[model samples]
Target chain A: MTPDERGEDSAIDVPDALAALLGADTVWTEPPDIADELVARIEQEARLQGDDQPRPAAAGRPRPWRRWAMAGAAAAAVIVGIALVVNSADDDDREPAGVEFAIVGTELAPDASGTGVVQVRPAGFAIIIEIQGLDPAVPGTFYQGWVRSDDGDLVAVGTFHAREDNGPIALWSGVDLDDYPTLTVTTQQIGAGTGSSGEQVLVARFDGS
Target chain B: MTARDEMAARFAAADPDAIRDLYVQYSGPVTTVAASILRDPQLAQDAVQQTFLNAWRGAHSFDPSRDIAPWLYAIARRAAIDIHRAEQRRRTEGGHDLDVAVTPLAFDRTWEAWEVRRALGELPDDEREIVRLAHFEGRTHSEIAALTGIALGTVKSRSHRAHKRLAHALRHLVDTENVS
Candidate 1:
């Protein structure tokens, strides 16, 4: 369903919503005033991670072009071809019950947004994402989406070439939403390396309700 | 340099006192942000602690000239997401269905509330009490005066002061909050 279809008015006004949050019913964790335990916990975690101060640059750190709305793994290699299945919704049978998520744009395509539905199949997970506000891919470039597992492994679910011009784009994944909780759409060139371009246009995480 | 920037400086240098002070100052709202996403109180608390730890690990990259909220927020959000994903994996391994995911509206709405909560935490204890009575308790100035034994005029004045401070602190949210 489109944003218009969703009828976005269920949310309360900001002030009223915020006021409710401050009410006694809302649970806001109050930190222990004493810092010893916090300090100890942090120190122990540091020791486990080698307590390296000024830590080395992270592979998943914010990209030079822009920071992701959330931290994520950089594209190691672009996975394309055979595994990607393009389908017209009219043809394939879909599971009655599927997990859904509100897709969000990363900085690379800040204006873009969408929703993703994942259906677990006997073969794998069949996914469909309806995207809005993104431009169509130009010649030689196509949009590819991936599902990243909790262990940082990436599977290329499917690919497409247009955004709002097309209806919902369907993709398939060999992994379930459990292990692969993140879905990322990145535009890639035909000749681009097998690794993901890392130029993420849209991303969504299906961690929990 | 401003005290905040000074704290950032010490924080970037791994000053223990500065680290502890920053945690004390911001942990409440950080936890609120985590809970807004994770929705589990215990996991939210763990996320807050992990956020601080992650901040310590990445402190060297922090720019002292800038505000620390965004940097700290990103880390807090990342920690919550990591935990959420792990929880999902754990659930699936034990046999369960996917829980309801957070909507973007909820995310936006809660961040504003979280920021306001953080600003509330920044207020002086006396002023914060007045805000709590006025907003949280739904008490009028006169009612607050009677309840807290502070004079009516004093309660009203303190309420005004606290609101002014909050408004000044949360100016960044003005445009975002005004949007429906």
Candidate 2:
């Protein structure tokens, strides 16, 4: 019988027509790593937010003028000794100037916050991130630092877990920061391989402003 | 609360697992919507990521009483369009091939395609299978009945039911398309 002859209440076969038009392959296939990478990035940001707490500044006790003079003399001697060693060493090994960025919470993560500093030396590169009030990483997940270039390419700088004892985690970035002025921290799953999770918990954009 | 409402609540709370669950459910269709526009798997994948990220960020804006699929599909479509524009600009500046042509009509088609697929997924197994065999496998109703060993009348009835439900579910999209 024709489809309409079946009855007014008969089920219409939409899938038949839809399947014919769209096909099975119309469903997009995701690479195995996409979800893991995305989740990791999200977790990284969450951990950073959970860890973002204000740390009190260190206050040194004032000393008497006589004691201060002796302390200054001792500091001067130490500085001279360090200068002499630096002058004796090869000029090619000198440390590059450090750059710092203030990382603030995005509107989605108002309580998530951190501070980032990039220290570049001729021999090596290091980024120190001080995070406060970030949630501890969920099981099997850890936080990763990402460097995004102006052209929109993202590179993983390093990964770390939040620890109760550590105030700030320092990571070595193999690449120079001049080309990658944007630093982002993301939470990533353990086996997500290499890629920014795109879950930027905290982002520090240095626009030369 | 229903599963969708619960999911919406979890998303509003910034629950990572909720976001993950949403990803597992919708990523495929979202990717399809994106890939159709961007015409690049890598860029489409990036759009999927951005879509979920935007959803997570704007979860508060979602009403739990509403259907979550359409909301996410909207976000995914917008993300794909954004990436498409960016790629277009990049290609234009670099003097590269600018063959990627997308318009509002194309986007509406993609959205309709996604909505149909999503509605099909919600159908009963028997009905879904019959429809798939008839449409996807390009089999006749009699062929589907023979292959499945179901009665011919039952096969036709299930197929008709599935079609009716889909038409009702997608009436809004169809109306919107027409209006636009």
Candidate 3:
């Protein structure tokens, strides 16, 4: 039935409706916190199961491109760490779903606000910065991303601006692993302006392998 | 709490404060869904935590007008199911747990709900999201049009088509299953 057919009732039994989308055994999982003790038990079992194993990277390191929102000082590193562990084990439990893609290290780019994930494949790393909250640069001004070396030289990765014509821009391309250990993006006021807007957004960096 | 209240009080800007509260609020429902599928409590908590972390990064993608529960639950369900199914595959591929073949059905009144969920998953992402908001969330056609920022007519027709495809895909299951 369409939305019109169902009317405006807010009482739809969504869990039941989505049970099929999730398969039959999914809904009974509703209610209760799954118990803290149970979680601890599972963690212990998981640890025991993988006790002898070494993880691919250190825990809680944010992927590139997910750091834009962190300009405000949010420590998303731990969040990223939890994610890697889960993604590593996802295929073992659920049916495959959602759009799948591959990045060769050049496809990653900053969003319209010049923020996004840097795809670094050789090092087995990728990270994204939150960009939904940044104020867009005005006309005659644009955000440019650069790869900075320890010697203070800067290499241009790309440049972008916030515009209504383009939806939220994201750097989806992958890039070379060595060119950019320190990645930064700055807002260049092309027209006559004072000092830096101090709005250069440092999106994300790669984990050195 | 009201949906607006939850959004404002728990997730104003996706900081740790909002993330932590959001975790506490939905952790119960998330845990329940995960545990039901994995049949393991520890696995369920990990799944719930994963779901919240996902919501944290992707909360910007959420439409504020829609109910947060279903959206969060859906993500959690997928995580839990993924973990459970992956475990199943490992056990079987390595030659274990051969006794279980299919998931047990969870309800009686309508297999239609289950069928709809399955068909929605098969639809392209755009169409699937529209059907989910319209049918599963009980949003009015206008409400869906506004929340998704899509045309109202598109929402109407897509939902209908989604239901039609659901019935077709589930006809066999309906016939054999003990659906009321």
Candidate 4:
């Protein structure tokens, strides 16, 4: 039956959800350089409150503090930083979302390849999209990039015409990548309404964070 | 007092470095719990940052005789929910609000995830890599050997060792009923 019923280990007796989560290759993505931020925030708050209590000096030793017995093994290793994963669906609100998505061309442009470097700034989701081997957005038409949600909602990041020497294009997004993980580029006619023209030129799906 | 009790006492005193010490120690599992609720990595991280800040603010009420993990977990859960609600409101402001609220995982579900993640972090680098290849990536022994450049026999042995260590390290997840 199960690993537990098979008399393996009691720990393997996890529920299906727990087992799946354990096997999932995701560590909770922490933002880069958060510790420094935390330290600064704490110090600032302390000062604002006029906290004059003597503080302990930063320690470099591995076992400077004790942990809950249950976390003995995990906390013993002196781990510091975590893998950084950025998702700026709506906030594009505050911090940075820095996952890179490799954009590839569809049947329309087989030789196209580039990347979307996402950043979540206060303005919105800034998607720095660049696809090589694409033509310039001519006078009557342009290229528009979209981040599509799983539910099929699309938010246009930006539009550009890739000239011979035109560099990467930065498009803004109003959605979080967690909810909208797909990226698509289409050729938009000058007056083809505001909808995706469906003349697919490029597409990139964020397969991972 | 136990080392944990001492730390909690210092935390209640609002020692910045002491809290940093606590963050260094517990941030991983704390974020794991928060991420379980929020599902957004950056938001989960924000919840964690706020959790420590809230803990510092409310440190005066902490009972040094009690465990800091549960107290911090309570604060972390609140911070995550608060962030989730804020994100919901942001979506509404942008006219993208959904009608339903995201369901929170069962306490044990989050706890188990936290424990497994913590235990995985404690594993020796080689053994952890083996587990990642075997369980996480679903790679075969020979496949793991080719991928990781470790010998097949050694891979098998490390797999066994890793499983053993995981079993021992995570026994509390199964044994405890007091977790909330």
Interface RMSD of each: 13.0, 7.0, 14.4, 8.3
Tell me the whole-model lDDT of each prediction, alpha carbons only. 0.63, 0.62, 0.46, 0.64
Model 1 has a DockQ score of 0.13
Write model 3 residue lDDT over A113-179, tens digit each, in one string. 3233432222232323334434455433555555556665565444444433435333322343344
Question: Where does candidate 1 stray beyond 4 Å?
Answer: A1-18, A24-28, A32-34, A41-209, B97-105, B176-180
Kindly state the number of residue pairs that clash in model 2.
28
User: What would the TM-score be for candidate 3 when compared with the true structure?
Assistant: 0.30
lDDT by residue for model 4 over A22-45, one digit each (tens)?
A: 565344333223465456446545
* Model 2 TM-score relative to the real fold: 0.54
DockQ of 2: 0.12
Off by over 4 Å in 4: A1-18, A25-32, A51-209, B1-6, B99-101, B104-108, B175-180
lDDT of 3 at A40: 30
Q: Assess every candidate by TM-score.
A: 0.50, 0.54, 0.30, 0.51
Q: What is the lDDT of residue B158 in candidate 1?
A: 76
**What is the alpha-carbon lDDT for the whole of candidate 3?**
0.46
Which lDDT tens digits does candidate 1 get at residues A168-202? Answer: 77676655566677898998765445579989999
- Can you tell me which runs of candidate 2 are displaced by over 4 Å? A1-33, A54-209, B63-67, B101-105, B142-157, B173-180
Could you give candidate 4's per-residue lDDT for residues B1-180 as a string of tens digits? 877678888888888767777887678778877777776655665577678878888989998788787777788778878877877876788798565346455544666666777787788989888777656665666777899888887877787788778767876764563233
Ranking 2 against 3 by TM-score, winner: 2
